[model samples]
Target: MTPGRPDPARRRWRRIAVVTAVVLALAGANGPWLYRFGSEKYHAYRIDRPEYKARNGRWEIVEFPEGYRQNTIHAALLRTGKVLLVAGSGNDQENFDARRFDTRVWDPVKGTVKKVPTPSDLFCTGHTQLADGNLLIAGGTQRYEKLKGDVTKAGGLMVVHNENPDKPMTIEAGTRFTGRKNGKTFVAQDAVLVPRARKRFDPETGRFLGNDAGLSRVYVEAERRGARHETGAEDNYRVQGLRGADARNTYGIAQKLALDKKDFQGIRDAYEFDPVAERYVKVDPMKEARWYPTLTTLSDGKVLSVSGLDEVGQLVPGKNEVYDPATRSWEYTGKERQFPTYPALFLTQSGKVFYSGSNAGYGPADKGRDPGVWDVRTNEFTKVPGMSDPDRLETSGTVLLPPAQDEKYLVIGGGGVGESRASTRRTRLVDLRAKNPRFTDGPSLGRGTRYPQSSILPDDTVLVSGGSEDYRGRSGSDILEARLYDPDRNSFRRVADPLVGRNYHAGSLLLPDGRVMFFGSDPLFADPANSRPGVFEQRIEVYTPPYLYRGGRPVVEGGPGTLRRGGTAVFRSPDAARLETARLIRPSASTHVTDVDQRSIALGLERTAGGVEVTVPKNRNLVQPGWYMLFLTDRDGVPSTARWVRVP
Candidate 1:
């Protein structure tokens, strides 16, 4: 134009240019919205539904031919195609002490259950498959006690007097009352006052002592330190006579004494069950007694036993032991390698152990709860970041998805600590192959769950079933709907729901015939309320995936029952031309949402005249010495029944 003004012809051109500029700006601002609309419309017909294929698997309730003797607390798929079920009193302390038959052999093919005598109570024990196809079970509960009685009556309380004395201090039982003595903090354990003897009896130790003695003695030291005031005889008389009306004076009294030895004792017995001989042979016990421990098979074939309560029912966070199958004995690995009780530890391809952050019951809430890469050799733990809802993963299921070469780890549903009314539906995945491994959000389940079962299917998919939506299946939190997780798509599809609601103590395993069996569910921990009086879950159900219904399953005519490392396996299958994938899945020994020694490795497949030849990798880390289920899938992803193959 002319500096600030334009001529008539030039003004028209200027106006047109400004209008075009404005239009372009507006279009740029709305570009993403327009593009999204157009892209969605274009792909509307192509958007595929979440695959449930194999023809949509179905679940059927199957009754145990001669129902289980006890609730199924532990289950393992034997190399012989039968299942080994162990209950060990099934959380029934009375029955357990009475020597009830707690072990059984479940023959799925014959629909029969055979009882096996167990030497000790295997309740709350940990187990993993050894290289010889035998199960090494270790660390079980000597005894357990449910919380009972009034909060104040069992454990004495402590009251703090401050400027606001009228507020009335509310001291709860189990709350640690600490005092300062010699510049050190002293903690007072629970105690009950014996007014007649002018002393307190340590019920936990079954010993009567002075009111200010033993654990509670710290309170006396604290009184000298002026940390708090301990009311004397006059106050006790007024409080005890008023029927606890003046709780303030009694607030300093210790109610519940120490726990009894029988309540927290950990068993030292360790045994290896020979599935073929159907007998349990006692092995060298652990260096430290453990209850509720986790037995993990290391990449080098040695079993790592970590976490658990010690001889006295106390969480042993830093005391870990390694079991050498060669020596058939356990060696203490020191406290540095200690982890949370029942941590779901996965064997990485690099020979490192990955803690999946899924713990069963007991441990330090802060230390061993984080997911990390643990070097057993160096005792180094590298925490993996980016896990969602890590705090509430108690009893959650975790697994290294199929094609172990991918190096991906996944953790599914779990609940909060103790009796907290919280559960989670969150799932996370981490790629161990990454330079700095971190978790990423994965698929969520249909509902929040605790103690869910995740089983690796023959078709490289994971079937997740059972678990409660709340803590201990309260308020009808028992979930029955099952789901299938497809790693290829990173999505979850709803599968058929089972008839019984499995929660707390439930287990599942992949059957050799491409089916999945789900059993055991003790929601109340053997203390079923009057509303649901019967406690134990004695029923078993088998899930038949859609692949089974698909007509003409590729027949695995024959294959070597045993294989060698770095060996080639020639499988006789008439549908070799149609075969698309070959996979080897380790037999699962699953319990308490912990599936020990379960892994899937994809075998390199090559078509032959009438069968397929598969090359097994030589890496022992990828294919540890153990029994595996070899399966063949057709081009349609329909898998054939697995054939048991041992790599020894």
Candidate 2:
């Protein structure tokens, strides 16, 4: 419109152009920040949408108050609907030395946390849900491990022998043993009770046989810390403070005592955590100390404790025992069946223990690695075959599928034994009902995973989530993925991604409210480079599945607190007409990705006028005597808030 610069229109047009250019320049300088802000806003809006939640579910982080947070290495869902978070020394040597054991009871619904006074370091202990709704907790940290370079004292196992056949004797703690050949002295760290020598007799003719010395194992460390104090060969040690008959009756024998890497040691402490009282009730300690053991409830309501590092920081060597709730005592099984630490052993419908060959760690790779069905009474082990990636079973997650009658199990992803980098994406399914129960390849994960946590939902679906592609999340390999596995279809549906990365020391629990709670992740490193040490994940994450976002759930108003086996228990529910399935899911007592306590049992549901009558399974093995969350699901697959029920 303007040709000459003197024209007013031309000048006005030039000024407008300059203003536009300046505005564009300013926007370019702040473009990245503005884009990020807009993108975050859109993401928040999209995830919160009702339809999005209905399709993908939702995840929310729960951060505790500063004072209550802890490194939760073990978690159990109590009958009171609260979670027991146990840290013990929390893998912290300083805390162990300071005796700062920790335990917390967290009410998920009320959002309240209460601290409990822990009796000992229950780190790496074994736990199972008892018949009377108490958690039978056994074993713990006797001593922390020392690496090769970190070890300053020479210590090892010392077998004390008793030649006297008359009476048993106790070698008190602080008793010194002098090496007869090496002239070195070592002190016992704990008391050893040597039983009376057994007078053997020939069963055929009742002839007297030579007396066998009673033996007991005890750990001893050198009097002082030095390489010179280490023993290179087997040596006989004289019992100090003993004279004449006592000295001749008792002696000590040891192999090599060196400054080698010492493993984590265990204790014999046992407790029954009362959910009502919210405290630990000390019971008779186990005869043998165990760390990283697996406590499985037998068909007779006895808890079978098996496989762990003993007080001497060595494998327990098949010394299995059972805890009888009636006597509140532990008795040796009188049978020898060895397993690796935290072996995935589940009680089958046939009243036998089914070992999945999935273990945490610590055992000879060649020994006790086969999956089998073990008869505790008969000591029979029938090996199950056809396992894929058998070497990678360590750290794998084994879950018994819903409807306990099916006797089907899915063993998900695992890694190589003991910090090995090898991992597998394959999942193995075994149906024990089949005449030949063998592990068959099931659905595979997107990538290799270890320490994956799987929880059985009331809707008969399983939520498999979290794990790392590497050992202990090395090199920041924690997978932030979640999937809902449909047992009917035998396929996995990818859901919303988890905001947190979880690997070793992580587990999941199905809450009574139909949501799932995830806790604890002890990654080896925080950064991808793994140059820095990882911090334990203390903040909990609760997941609301897509089924919850669909519609109003069936509400279980009133129900009988106790249901006898083979008996029907009527529960008042206005939506009984809509109820199609009932499930009794045992609350999870999970640690190290090993949860033998969780099993979903299908209940017989008969719709009544104002309620539903549910029948319990008669088989004790199928329906373990314990507290379970009774959930009623409508035709829409929406499950009601669980009603606490005890199956007697």
Predicted candidate 1 versus true structure: per-residue lDDT over 1-648, tens digit per residue: 557776889779999999999989988999999899999786543322224434456666777655455688899888888999998878876886577748989888888888898888888889998888899999786655434331112212233321222233332323343322212222333222322113557879968664432111112112132323332222211122222433333323332232112234467789999989988999998876788788888877899988787654567757688999999998877646666677888888889888988988876667678889899888888999998888888888889988899989889978787777778888989999999989998987867789888899888899888788877777667877878889999998886666788887788998888888988887664333427644777888888886776668898887788877778989888889999999989989888888857889999999998999999988898899988888899987788878888888
| Candidate 1, superposed: residue stretches over 4 Å from native | 1-54, 65-67, 146-264, 525-534
Candidate 2 all-Cα RMSD: 2.4
Query: What shift in Å separates residue 328 of candidate 2 from its native position after superposition?
Result: 0.5
The most accurate candidate by TM-score is 2
Q: Write the per-residue lDDT of candidate 2 for residues 1-648, one digit (tens) a residue.
A: 456447787779999999999989988998998899999999999999999999999999999999999889899999899999999989888999999999999999999999999999998999999989999999999999999999898999999999899988799999999999999999999998999899999999999998899999899999999999999999999999999988999999999999999999999999999999999999999999999999999999999999999999999999999999999999999999889999999999899999998899999998998999999999999999999999999999999998778999999999998989999999999999998888899898989999999999989999999999999999989999999988788899999889999888889999999899999999888899999999999999999999999999987887779989999988998888899999999999999999999999999999998999999989989988989999999998899999998887
Error of 1 at 443 (Å): 1.7
**Candidate achieving the largest lDDT:** 2
**Clash count, predicted structure 1:** 14
